[model samples]
Target: MLHLLPLRTPLAGLGLCVLAGAVHAQDTLTVYGIADMYSEGIWGGGGRVSRLQSGGLSGSRLGFRGRENLGGGLNADFVLETGLNMDEGTYGQNALFGRQSYVGFGYEPAGRILLGRQYSSLYNLSSDFSIFSNLSNGPSSAVVGGFGGYEPVRGSADSSTGNGGPARINNAVKYESPVWGGFRFGVLGGFGEVTNDAGGNRVVDAYARYAQGPVDIAAGYVDDRGGSVTPLAHRRSWIVGAAYSFGSLRLRGAYLAVDDRSVANQDGSGWWLGADYRLGVSLVKIQYVVNRPRYIDNARTEGLGIGYEYSLSKRTTLYTGVSYFRNQDGAGLGRASFSIPSGITSGTDNDLTQWVGGMRFSF
Candidate 1:
């Protein structure tokens, strides 16, 4: 079990002593981060807009991770990560360490167990099999929208609640199995912590993946329960994906389905297909995605994206991309993720287009 202690100044000396004594030659700690920013121009919703934003390709973050060896192939590990908004020098997820905060133990032959806030198994599966790397602005982003509740409008709460997706889960306990013959699996459970309610706001996620040589395949499932009402409502989702690489070229595809029991007419399915080619220090990629609502007539959205990236150095890259979306029968899908302009109107068929250029640095 894990214990928490108040961080009072009076205990500073004792804390330092404990930390100093805990370290050994085999223990390791590291600090790492990524800084990504982009300039974008969007055309649609009766206007044209230009702006600077963060997380064009990947979210900016600072993270600290450490592992302490305990002999016999056993180890203790911890990670704390915070998301950053590079455009405005602010927090991305509304909380410090909102990206990830977890501590766990690992045994070489027995797999691992972790506790705290972390990414959902469904999100990890999408990221692993996507050729676009599952960027929020990439074409393949739509495929995972069902895993997390799909919000047609921007600036709304996207948490794992009634109608939201399961991007991340809080107060979670997770178990990950070691790879055996190129197959690996994991499970996660998040507790709502509500008094007298065991099923309130609970989350259950699981996934399995197999990778050998240049081919990879994965599948995942999630059941998210919302406790806001007397009887909880569930958002259940499932997905399957695969990727293949041959020489400098790679292809990827995925299919996802959602059954939202809390809301009417929210059931849907989405799919994406994409490919990328590498040439020396440059890479080119393209993807197309389609999303269809099960109960809404003619309510569907399709997206197409093409991007180019050039490596400036081992730690820096330059990228540019263009994306287009066609919304039919009152669908409100946009080109970019959370950064979509407010002018776009829902309940009407609209076409959205975006152009972006960005630079990313990692350390």
Candidate 2:
């Protein structure tokens, strides 16, 4: 049960005749959220294509986070976050609080352990190293397919129509290790919640990262074990990425791979090269990406993205971005699908190009 209190009392003259303690209280909860939207035009999927979307700047969200120190280096923390559709009042991903819902215990030196729904360790590491946080409609989203560009052990493809792990997971347990001299690690497992043996754990993932001075690096792996006809497919995946920062410029690169038994032994790899320039009122970034998925034949994609961000303040910004992705001819042997909604086939194409523009706000 939750109790709410006011901060006023009327009987102060009678030496505390009113419930002053219940009437006066301090706020401990923090409310925060973001609203992002975009206009997009996709080509080569079939013919002419266009759509309006949220998350051009970032995934739109509304959430509340609260934590209270219980004393003795122990504290309680909880989060209730949900995705939003700026184009409509309805929820974007369908699931209520489709973004995340979790509660956990935290310790200063020991680290944090959380329960319920949350992001996979692989996702945590990837997003940390990504230049755009992998926004759905942002430049990175079009180039690398954001989080969807890789295997689906951690999440689903943004462009797929099939059910996906594009965002968060249910029945998940996550542990985040404390940063020791800029080094930290994380591990997580998700329950399939299936009865009568639908499959095993469904997914398990982990990652380790180090960031000190001007350089940052990380490595991670993810596995998806399931029996669904279209399961993310049991697979082994890994990523290695590094970034170096110099004054106002930062350069980064990453490699990714996935091998699966259920999915025709598909193999793929990708790399990123980019730089960011920060100005007093805005920031500009330019990046390039190349990914190839090996199938019976072979499929490849080369992408380029440029972005600009103008901050109105710390919590709000005006943002715009554009990207071009070329699907190499004769590179259509493997499944290298990436898009919003994840796993859905937009159409057939030997190539695809995209453009997006939008803004983001937080409160």
Candidate 3:
């Protein structure tokens, strides 16, 4: 008295489930990340020399991302990314959940708007200006004054906050517009994350960029209204850059200026130019950078760097580079970050020449 279902019908049901999964795939969550490591050495740290260290090739990190289609043209997206020290198993930047944590809506035609913790336009735009860019084997020459311990500011020094400028903003809202004909723009606001006065610790930032074919151009500015903190009372930073490529040859140039109203020499200006060429499985790049601290009486510094990278696979590569710095007027800007770690200092000086080599992998 029971009706028998066809055995093949089960297969059909399974096919339907698979099809449903695909159709609803946009509503599903996914996980993705990368792990990288490398060694580094510094010739001079303003005066002292440092030994080899891990993470010179790349900044090790792991992250997760998820997106959901909310019907119609709306979508939900979230990213929880964190950095790690591969050598010692230490976490990077901020507390446990500090790297990037936020949820936001996105539109294909319009753009993406994210809330919570994320990168600002300054970092987003200027990242390409540096040869290191989480890829080089050595430290960032931008750290010290550009000459190595001879310039006033050392590695990763906060020139803007030198005059009491605010560095990072909290409780910020960021908006990025889609590219139209190779042009796009971004704007962000930091809310101080304080419940007391709404506009007490507010900061505003914006940037515009254009990429047409092998040429890239961008400019940005950031203004921070310091809270009750010293040496961060007020700060402003501005940057501009252009890059172009022809065949296997590429060239780049950039300029940066920061104003810190707290330090004795509250104004600073910096600039750099470089080029890269590809040869079979290897890529070669060279760059020169400079910076000037305010009220330093013609205090300036410059750097010359050459880097090479060899591809091991589609997602893996090894690289090495060397740089020389010459300080003018006893300025040691070149060796600033030579011995300092990334995102660790504010307004210190360490000018020196640096050479770095490293490898990286991503998945």
lDDT of each candidate versus the true structure: 0.73, 0.63, 0.60
What would the per-residue lDDT of candidate 3 be over residues 212-283, giving only the tens digit for each residue?
A: 999899998877655544423455677788888899988877777776654443677777777788999898
* Candidate 2, 46-95: lDDT as tens digits: 45457888776667888866676778898877778888988887775566
Give me the displacement of residue 96 in model 3, in angstroms: 2.4
Give the clash count for each candidate: 4, 15, 45
For residues 1-363, could you state the per-residue lDDT of candidate 1 as single tens digits?
Answer: 122232345455366445333333326656688999999887875677888988877789988777877899999888888999999999866669978899999999999999988887667766666666666555655333532344321212234353223777788899999999999999998886777978777878899999999989998988877555424457787889999999999999888787878745377777788899999999999998887777667767788889999999988999998888776765454334435567654545367787889999998
Candidate 2's TM-score reads 0.81
TM-score of each: 0.87, 0.81, 0.78
Angstrom error of the Cα, residue 119, model 3: value is 1.0
The reply for model 3, stretches above 4 Å from the true place, is 1-30, 45-50, 134-141, 144-168, 262-265, 328-334, 340-351
lDDT rank order: 1, 2, 3
Please give the RMSD of candidate 2 to the true structure: 6.0
Residue ranges of candidate 1 with Cα displaced over 4 Å: 1-26, 142-165, 229-231, 263-265, 331-338, 345-349
User: What's the candidate order when arranged by decreasing TM-score?
Assistant: 1, 2, 3
What stretches of model 2 exceed 4 Å from their correct place?
A: 1-27, 138-154, 157-167, 196-199, 228-232, 330-349
Report clash pairs, candidate 1. 148-165, 148-166, 149-164, 149-165
